[model samples]
Target: MTFPLIKHVRAFVVRGGGADYHDQGSGHWIDDHIATPMSRYPEYRQSRQSFGINVLGTLVVEIEAADGTVGFAVTTGGEPAAYIVEKHLARFLEGASVTDYEKIWDQMYFSTQFYGRKGLVVNALSGVDLALWDLLGKLRKEPVYQLLGGKVREELQFYATSSRPDLSKKLGFIGGKMPLHHGPAEGEEGLKKNIAELAEMRERVGDDFWLMLDCWMSLDLNYATRLAHEAHKHGLKWIEEALSPDDYWGYRDLKKNAPKGMLVTTGEHEATRWGFRMLLEMDCCDIIQPDVGWCGGITELIKISALADARGVMVIPHGSSVYSYHFVITRHNSPFAEFLMMAPDADKVVPMFNPLLLDEPVPVNGRLKLDDKPGFGVQLNPACKLHRPYTH
Candidate 1:
């Protein structure tokens, strides 16, 4: 099928559009503690807060073809990303053929190397690339996964990343991962407390359920190793982003020395294939977790996953709602997905990107199955007030 030309690229910033997966106001242990990453430090521990601003903001992108077919995606870097999308990135996609996304992605990546190798620029690039894929899928009357290849699994099993593992188990999720509250700065006493909570949760969930820790880039190699050593007896499945993302050497050490059978996963903050190559080549971690919205969108993720697939490493894109669902369903190595339980109290499950994207799918029985809809099977919520933060 000959698809129409890519006619326009546009982006908007919407406020009040995110989920508090951390359950900040729930008064739960970690939820009630640590407002910012800095709070983990001993000096700032007492100054912790309950919430921050981004919970209500996002950037949404849309790519329109000549025939008026539109594909869109929503991401966290909405305001800043809009600047990249309009001031620069739009030039590469507008007037290009819809099928020329790979070429467009390469051009966008290389052309912006001076100022956009990673971070917000790549995030903007990712939104645009995803919109292009959505456009191509719409033109072919197929979902993005079908366009990628085809489904590699019958259904996507999910593990919950929330405070309430018991609730997650009751909801039929395969496993539950909790955010670690303390780090090395808290000393040995803090490490003991971390283990104590994990042990309590393990007992609550029983022996068969999988338990994991999301350290959230808040530990040193020694702290992560010690935490892993203690968490091992609690049946921890893996430890995620325990150290700073730049610590490739630390990651290599943690993975090499982690408790036997414990998996190490990072890259939720890492972007692009080149960035991922650092992790893969150095043998940094056991699994690679890329958020397609941040890791150069769907385009860079495919390349990252291809590299990981070749190396026998897993490529589970972080819990990014529809953006990730399309990719995970098609890859063989991404056996399970991370579902961010957005329920404020961690008492109920809801759509991850509510008030921004319509027709968003939620998992059933710890498994997610995509519907047979064209493009991503989702649309911008008409009720979502979109404001263009920049003029192009």
Candidate 2:
């Protein structure tokens, strides 16, 4: 079968909550007192935004086929990422076969290898790669899952991430993950407060509901180990991203010393198959969490998943809304998905990427059944203004 060649590639930047989920306004739960690496500074400890976590607004990448079909994706990168897409990555897509994503990805990765093995460069590549897959699904007139492979499960079951696991339980979710408020910098009193919060939530939700802590890469080995041992008493399912993504040895030690039956998971910030290889080979954690938008998109994720699956490790992607859903439904290792409670109070379920995507799906009773629509089954909201930051 013949395919239309890629016609053009474009990049745009938008502010506020779209893909840069961190660029939220005041009082949003996501930015409220979450522990981070910068928490050691007294001035930056209260809010993540205070430390410039949301400096990168959102970047939108669009790829148009010669046949006039357009596929696009959003991720955290802003104007810098837009520049990478327009000035560097677009060259590999224009005039190539729409289905030549493998070659295009290789070109994009290696061409920028001097400065682009991970972080912002990989983020830009990921946005472009996902747009290509969306384009392929549209061209084939099938849902992205169908193109990847038929569904392994009928529907996806989700655990909520928020400040209120108690509220999430009332909403019918299977489990809840809360951010660890105080880090190593806060001393013994902060440690007691952290455990107190867990114990209180455990009592409210009762036992058997999964309760986990997201440390957000803010702890050292000693602190994470102590926290995990303490949290285990309250039936903590896992302690996530406790150490820096680069600290493989710390993760290995923490995983080993962690209370029996508890999981140690990380990888939201790690990118590419090579980075994941280190984690699996070193037996870093029980599960691996890769954000689809940040971990080299679907193409690289496939390779990363295979690595984890071989080692008997679970693959649970970080909250990326539809981008993660389409891929999760197709993998056996991906047993359940994550739904981040973006509601300001974490009281009601809201679209994870609200106001940016039209027809975005949300869980009903903590479960979601995907539709047959093609290309991730979403459209960019016309109401949100988008600025083209660069032109190729």
Tens-place lDDT digits, model 2, residues 131-220: 999999999998889988989999999999999999999998999999999999999999999999999999999998999999999999
- After superposition, the stretches of candidate 1 with alpha carbons farther than 4 Å from their true spots are 19-31, 34-37, 40-56
Question: TM-score of predicted model 1?
Answer: 0.94
lDDT assessment of candidate 1: 0.83
User: What are the root-mean-square deviations of the candidates from the true structure over C-alphas?
Assistant: 2.3, 0.6
**How well does model 2 score by local distance difference test?**
0.94
Backbone clashes in candidate 1 total: 2
For each candidate in the order shown, give its overall lDDT on alpha carbons. Answer: 0.83, 0.94
How many Å off is the CA of 293 in candidate 1?
0.6
